[model samples]
Target: EAGVAQSPRYKIIEKRQSVAFWCNPISGHATLYWYQQILGQGPKLLIQFQNNGVVDDSQLPKDRFSAERLKGVDSTLKIQPAKLEDSAVYLCASSLRQGQGFYEQYFGPGTRLTVT
Candidate 1:
């Protein structure tokens, strides 16, 4: 099975600018997720999608961050007017399904964003 794929791998941007990251999940997976992992903290879920429909996005910062999984396959995350504290690793993950009782999420290497 193919693992998750993410791009750029690294980014540096000034505060108040915008940045975006992309992800492609493993084949045959039914659930996808995006997470923000700050230094010294575990990944925090930004959004979750199940076959193109949003399952959860309560933790996402509406004013500055947005994401979408259009085809239930590839996904993108965007942060506009970036803040200094937004510097972190944006991780993408996928799983079989929520009901499978298998919460083991396979993660991508992640895109590390730095705001200077």
Candidate 2:
């Protein structure tokens, strides 16, 4: 009955500082995702993992951002030398099933990061 969970409910960092985030998806879920949401914009998918394997990450800022889902249960996202533009809410989500069919993706209480 549990859902996704993210750590450090909020974070504040200076420009060029590094930061890390953690997420735990619902049990039995097979797909996980990470997204970035700006103050006034819709969440943008950053990366996706399907059972310990990466499915998509073309939108991720490779130069400074990285994410991994180990053992297909827990996931972590990190940013190094973060830019001010990186200020946003980092959201973690998971779905019980994923594919061509429609399924619900549950989201966690996002990690709000502020860059100064």
TM-score quality measure for candidate 2: 0.96
For residues 1-116, write the lDDT of model 2, one tens digit per residue.
98788998999999999999999999999999999999999999999999999988999999999998878899999999899999999999999766834878899999999999
Q: In model 2, which regions exceed 4 Å deviation? A: none
- Candidate 1 residue-wise lDDT, 31-109, digit = tens: 9999999999999999998978899999999999999888888999999999999999999999988667657889999
Clashing pairs for predicted structure model 1, backbone only: none
Considering every candidate listed, which one attains the maximal lDDT? 2
The per-residue C-alpha lDDT of model 1 at residue 87 equals 96
The total of clashing pairs for model 1 equals 0
Clashes of 2: 0
- Give the TM-score of each candidate: 0.96, 0.96
